[model samples]
Target: MKKIAITGATGFVGTNLEKYLKRSYKVRTLSVRYVHDQIFNITDDIIIHLAGKAHDLKKVSNPQEYYESNFELTKQLFDAFIVSKADVFIFMSTVKAVADKIDGVLTEEDLPNPQTHYGIAKRQAEEYILGKEISKEKRVFIIRPCMIHGPGNKGNLNLLYNVVKKRIPYPLAAFQNERSFLGIDNFNFMILKILENKNIASGVYNFADDEVLSTNELVQIISETLNKKNLSLAIPKSIINGIAKFGDLVKFPLNSETIQKLTENYRVSNQNIKNAIGVDKLPNTAQQGLEQTIKSFSKK
Candidate 1:
């Protein structure tokens, strides 16, 4: 069995991947407080670096938080990979590195113009890794995945689920928008496939559940999964947009961050990931994954 090193094992993505990896490999973790020492001998091992600064909702996170955790930490890890002679290195980056708001379907070709400090920091790390020199035994990959959600995740999706569970009508029903998200199941599968498939070229890739769900569709899924009536109103979008504008002016809860999330067309394409995995099939559809997550949410 091969040796595997993972950072952010406590995070949703890393924890999900570890479930399968621990069964067949010598799995190790690089704790949040430690770096470039001890069990982190990357020699002849696979390193999946998942630790990074997550996007801050309240905009309270300092700019240095992103650089120190995302860029500097990754830099330290990559330097260790070089010294320890690692074979494959996977960096868990985010779609925000490419664009914070999307006008259409996001692909690997889009030039990165990250708006937030978090995105900027991740993008900087990506640039640094891409600029490095490597020998025959080493490979590097930067994977930018959209919002990842799963059963145990307590993210925006779960918040939406809770709000819907309370039968609170979503105010944004006025905006018919589509967005993409990665199911943790599919993400775990993709990471494993990428690690195993040597023919897949080393570079950047985007991962997401294939189906694009509108906000209303997402609410309906939650409602049905929890056995509630689909209670939504399709009010005119103009009112909602105006309200969002006012929210921004007042720094209200439905402020710029929330508006961008609820209305942005963050439809990232999974073609590069599919091509790398040497298949057109995804392990789980968006609906299936969402169902599983909502079921878990109800139990909690």
Candidate 2:
């Protein structure tokens, strides 16, 4: 069996991916921390780099942390992979590397203009990886996955779940917006397909679920899962804007940035990846996967 080494194996996605891939491949967790001029000794046939500084919603993390963890660490690891025996190198990037807000459907064709340190750092690593010349024997892929959610993930979705669980009225229901999400199962499927097929080509691919859901729809789904009444209040958009501005003054969590995140059009196109993988549809639909995630939250 082929051996796979995964960084950030203890993270939400990493833990789920390890379990999913171990059934078919010899999987091992790799502990990687950023240090200058550090040498990585890798012998696995496949390497999935997942360790990186996540986006800080609370805005408390140091900006340099993103550069060191996302850019510097990846540069070092890719350098190691270039000389190592690894045939496949997969870097888990984010769609935010391209843009923080999209006016239309985000595609691979769009030029990158990242705003946050996290996105900027990831973009730097991507440029470095794509600039390098590689031998025909090896393949390199930089996957940009949008808001990924699953059973054990305690991301923004979890926060939303809690709000709905407590029967809080969703105040952003008035703003209609659509966003893409990546389920852990579909994410693992994509990774396995990339590892198994060499014809998929080595390049950047935007990964997301097939269906897009609005914030109100998501709230409804959570309410359905919890068997509670959907308390989505259709407050006026102007009032919400005023409240957000006031929040900025009061240092409330519902600031302009958070409100924008709650209501934004971030539709990602997974058509390129779907074509590359030769699949018309992923194994799990967006609703199905999200429902599963909601169910898991209920169990906890």
Candidate 3:
């Protein structure tokens, strides 16, 4: 079995991938709390750099937090990989590295024009990796995945689940936006496939689910999973904006940050990646992947 080393093993995607990869590969995972001893034993293996700082949702803090963890830390890890002579390198980059607000479907051709510091930092790290000339025999794959969702995810999904559990009426149902989200299962399958193939070129690839989903669809699915009626209001976006602004002034939950998240078009196209991989399409459809995720909420 091929040995695999992973950073951010305790995180959402890492833990999920670890569970699946243990079935076939010998896996070594790293944590900041641990020493180099955790990553030292695994030499000449495939390293999946899943560790990085995510975008700050609060919109209040220093931008350095992103660069320190995402760029600087990744540089440290990639340097170690170079000396170790790792066979393959897979870096978990984000679509945000390309744009803060994707006006239309985003493709690989777009030159990165990141908005926030988080995006800027990740883009810098990606450039650093791509600029380097590693061993001719080795392969490198940089993956820019859109909003990823699965059972163990602790981000937006958790908030949606809470809202459903509380039976709060979703107010911003009028906005129709298409957004792409990757299921963890499909991501795992794609990563494993990349590891198995040697002829695949070393370059950047965009990863996402088969189709885009709207917020209304998400709400309906969540309600179905919880076996409850969909309680949502298709109010005007302007009115909702007004309410969000008031909420922001009063220190309420539905502030500007939440409004932006709850209603934004971040649709991404994986056609370029599909063509590069010489594959027809994704392994699972968007509906299938999302249903599986919704069902998992009742597992615990």
Candidate 4:
């Protein structure tokens, strides 16, 4: 079995990936962090770099921490991968590295103009990887995944699930916007397929579920999973805005920033990755994957 070394092995995605890859490849979790001139000991045939400073939703994180952890650490690891015997290098980048709010469907062809420190740092790492020259034998995949969710994910999806479970009516249905999400199963499938197929080439690929769903649609999915009636109120945007502005003063969870995040258009296209992986459809449909996620909530 080909040995694979995964950084950030304790994270949600990394832990899942380590379990998934263990079925075929010999997988080992590597505990690594950002340190200047840090030399990595990588004896595995494949290196999966999943460690990075995630985007801080609270805006309290030090901006420089993002650069050090996301950019500098990735640079150090990639440098090691290039010189080591590893033939495959997979970097887990985010769609945020491209745009904060995508007007249309985000694709690999879109010009990257990141707005936050997290995005800018990741983009810098991507640029550094792309600028380097590697031999034909090596494969480097810069994967940009959007809003990844699974059983272990404790993101906004969990919050939405809880709201639906409590039978709280969704009030922001008026803000009709589509967003893309990636299921962890499909994400694992994509990574495995890329590792198996050398013809996939070394390039940037955006990964998302085949279908895009609106926020209303997501609430419906959560409701359906809980076997409850979905009640979505099409409250006017102005009313919601006023409430959110008031929330900002009292430090409520439904503040202006949270409301914007709760309803924003972040559609991403998985065409390039699907075409490269030679798959017409992923293993899990968008709804199926979402239903699975919602069901996991009941177990907790």
For candidate 3, the per-residue lDDT at 258 reads 84
TM-score-sorted candidate list, best first:
2, 4, 1, 3
- Model 2: runs farther than 4 Å from truth? none
Give the TM-score (vs. native) of candidate 2. Answer: 0.98
What C-alpha RMSD separates each model from the true structure?
2.3, 1.0, 2.7, 1.1
Residue-level lDDT of model 1, residues 1-300, one tens digit each, is: 888988899888788888878877788876754343423345548899998878987679878888988988888788879877568899999999999888888998999999989999999999999999977778899999998889898588866787788988777776778888788888988888887778888889998999899888898899999899877877677776777799988977766567667766778899988987888879899999989988998787
C-alpha positional error of residue 174 in candidate 3 after TM-score superposition, expressed in Å: 1.3
State which candidate has the highest lDDT: 2
Q: Compared to the true structure, candidate 1 yields what TM-score?
A: 0.93
TM-score of each: 0.93, 0.98, 0.91, 0.97
lDDT scores in order: 0.84, 0.93, 0.83, 0.92
Candidate 3: residue 86 Cα off by (Å): 1.5
| Candidate 4 ranges with C-alpha deviation above 4 Å | none
Q: So what's the TM-score on candidate 3? A: 0.91
Give the C-alpha lDDT of model 3: 0.83
Choose 2 or 3, whichever is better by lDDT. 2
> In order, how many clashes per candidate?
0, 0, 0, 0
Off by over 4 Å in 3: 32-42, 59-62
Comparing 1 and 3 on TM-score, the stronger one: 1
Candidate 4 positional error at 9, Å? 1.1
* Weakest ten-residue segment in model 3 by summed lDDT: 33-42
